[model samples]
Target chain A: MNKTGRPQDLPLSNPRADRVRDVAKLAGRPARLKRGHFLVEGPQAVREALKLHQERLAGGEPGVVTEVFASEACLDRYPEFEDLAEGTNARLATDEVLAAMADTVNPQGIIAVCRFVDVSLDTVLDAGPRLIAVLCQVRDPGNAGTVLRAADSAGADAVVLTASSVDIYNPKAVRSTAGSLFHLPVVLGADAAELAAACRARGIGILAADGYGSLNLDALQDENARRRLTGAGPASAFDLGAPTAWLFGNEAQGLSAGELDLADHRVAVPIYGAAESLNLGTAATVCLYASARSQQEPAHGETTHE
Target chain B: MNKTGRPQDLPLSNPRADRVRDVAKLAGRPARLKRGHFLVEGPQAVREALKLHQERLAGGEPGVVTEVFASEACLDRYPEFEDLAEGTNARLATDEVLAAMADTVNPQGIIAVCRFVDVSLDTVLDAGPRLIAVLCQVRDPGNAGTVLRAADSAGADAVVLTASSVDIYNPKAVRSTAGSLFHLPVVLGADAAELAAACRARGIGILAADGYGSLNLDALQDENARRRLTGAGPASAFDLGAPTAWLFGNEAQGLSAGELDLADHRVAVPIYGAAESLNLGTAATVCLYASARSQQEPAHGETTHE
Candidate 1:
């Protein structure tokens, strides 16, 4: 070990090494469950993982990034990694070794093996978060990851996935998130009816993103704006600015009827054109942004009703 | 030919038939280009194609669906196809033949051979369109199709793809569109420079979706709402309610320098959280929806300002 405890000297040159295969096994679910770690690929995701790891370490918490592997070229391209990898189990590996260890065809010369960062639904709810996004039986890894990314973009406090959802730690899902997986708290394998009940008890409203819902999302946003600007509008069906959790459904069939029944309101993103419905990611983005915008602190000096 | 003009029976069951080979070949680019036809798979897509074809045929114009193939099970599941595919060359095929002729592992027992529906850029521009989405160098077929579907959901008048973008007629692209391909006009192989000029000539403002852009999309929408409600806000940088064309760049690199320079403004969809930026489809959806909502006919009896 280096005297300064900064990772420097390991030269990992063999693609067929046991260590490399162990890292690569994170690509599958069984291996991930066995090791309690997942693959974070590409430069952007690896950077975020390292940042989170350093933050946790500073807080005297266990680090999130267990191991980081990079090539000299990658380190040169992204010099920040040198400092971020401080005290991390960082190794300089050949491109072949890095590729062999990563799930992606090209992991941008950097990959991180990160501890599973998901927290309990109780942990998320205890924070009194203003906004949360929940996925219900969403089967597509790409769609699940896209929603998670969109949730992060909207500044969602946490994202919850139902038990039937595709594994969030799936390699393709991680890549689709574009590093947002590290940006927000995540709750895995949540039970929707129980979660909805917990939210209601906490005074958090539940809204389902439904194609057949009677409540139009645009109407709610317009009303929120009207009340914000002129201090006058029709009585709102639901307060958009209030703490809320939005439930998004599967890509093809959308939310099941039971899932819809649990929400305080089933809100449909208005389709202005002839499209029957928006795709899952698109719908979730629009709905979350609607809540985000309305919940944003009033721009002027006016007092907020909330 | 049947006296009722309905597809009485084809009884086609040979998977090795030349007709099956020809249909299957449409999955490739060369065959599609040579015949000027694309494969439309899945029931929802085929129904939409059949509707468009019947509409054009009723208008004394050429039909869109040159051929339709379906199984009895599919027809039983989606009874509307029986009426929709009328007057077209519809035929019954066995599951094996249908599978052989399809691009998808399962074409859901229905597939259609459709003529390309993309229109000329001039046709779109001359239609006095209020809103359009232009994709520049977007290589992912799924990304391209998602944006197209989002544009349709937002009621965009048309969607334009720069020459460098993926071929919209590709099967994956068409599948991702979920039948929105037939919902709105598409202009393929457009030159971005010429398109910007054309839009300008038509009094349309061009906005590029850029991550580092100085303009915040949320701020613009806020100003738009203020102007609509209280009729007071800072002189807006740009009007969201005007005739506009939004330019979305590639998924990875985004719009090149030249593409960015062509826009009247580069508008960034606000990343309220730690996400660096929204993915291409998400960004395009938010941008298009903002324009669509702003350009919507004011619900109240407000007088016209445009």
Candidate 2:
């Protein structure tokens, strides 16, 4: 046995190992989540955790990873584990034990237990961010993950989850994010008032997308018109002040009346067809992409080839 | 029992009942689906099946309802069952029996066995003369449903799914439509070339949404613009030609090269953020809504509070 009391032998597979597997599943619960602990399954999530760990190390912070496990074969596959070996307490377990710990059908052969970092609204602003997405009461795991993935792709600073939003660390949500959860700062359980205050303090314009909103998103794309619209910056630039928060609501009931009332402006995507509303995740992507379009310079080079 | 020679009385809490349920499950298989048969469960889907039957009756077409079963209380609550009694056979079963036949938990107290309507591309065009969503290969059920629901909300004439697309009648797809599937013409397994040819014959411009396309969606929305954006109507009026097909593709692969080649013009939603792409459903919704916006007349009158 190793000093930590776990077997040092290359794969610990036994009936007693069930307790260890149960510990990984505990990460799915809210209580464990609140305790700042999460289980990273498979090599993909663990590799991402290690990447983040390295970034933190370079930035002069203690590595965030607490524990890591793999079979001897996994260790053999990744022999150059300089930083990982030094920082993380590694354990060798059997393939059966790893599979038992994994939530997915195909395990990636590596798992890590890590501490969740608290990303405050200030951290997002400090990251030199320009755009952010605020999800209000979005309960579906798939939608939440898609939004996170979209936010990361849009180069948004962070994804702020308002009260009642699905947990970011939910295995399904994490899986859906396709590794974007690691790349982006995800703030959960934030209150609307907190979000509003943070945006207000950051000089960020809060644009709420309501179906009834008078402002057409297309009109906002007009470079000269948008400058005239907001009465700020050059005609070619989008000047919604320092930062911008695009607020999205639940899939069924969109942004509430109270939330709409707090927005500096209300916007709507013009619809010609019979759809009552766009899906919540899709709407956020469109809105975020629209904002990005409004702010960026026109692209050069061959756009599309035949 | 009802002269069909099939078992009319379902035995609840019996091992044999499980086999009957298994038989019902087999009804959703592709062979059965291709043969124009599908199982309906819960009150909503069953109610929709009945309504479709009624519409067929009123239209002088052969009603495709094969079987209907309900608890005594369900029959009493619905009451309007003259056609159900006259045209198709009906059976009264215990709640447990009904549950055994049903696919969902808390079954809405009803179930139906109905023939799927093989809605043809020509029939879809004949029904409506204008807008259409021609899905190239949307493989996600949720995305397909969202597009269909969006098409319905946009008051689209029809939603045509090409080969390789997800089954529109998949329970998840149906649920995602939020009942819009029942109202709209959702024709599945269409040939892309045939659809493009049909739309061309109708003078409907085929606008494909390509991320790398040269034409911007906003540019198309402008009245003075000369180059036509795919899936868009003429600038002067909201009336998009005779009919238009908005082609969307798979979530990951997007529109195929051959599919893009068939389009009248490739159009794109400009992105300012880092997201490599929008989710398929979001892309379709945005483009579809953009087309809808282009067709909308200026809203007038005092905006009523909701």
| DockQ, 0 to 1 scale, candidate 2 | 0.28
State model 1's lDDT: 0.90
Clash pairs (backbone) in predicted model 1: none
Question: RMSD to the native, candidate 1?
Answer: 2.7
lDDT of 1 by residue, A23-101 (tens): 9999999999999999999899999999999999999999999999988788878778888888898888889999999
lDDT of 2 by residue, B184-239 (tens): 67788899998888788878888888898888765554432111222123453323
Tell me the number of clashing residue pairs for each predicted model.
0, 22
Residue A252: error of model 1 in Å? 1.9
The CAPRI quality class of candidate 1 comes to medium
lDDT of 2: 0.67
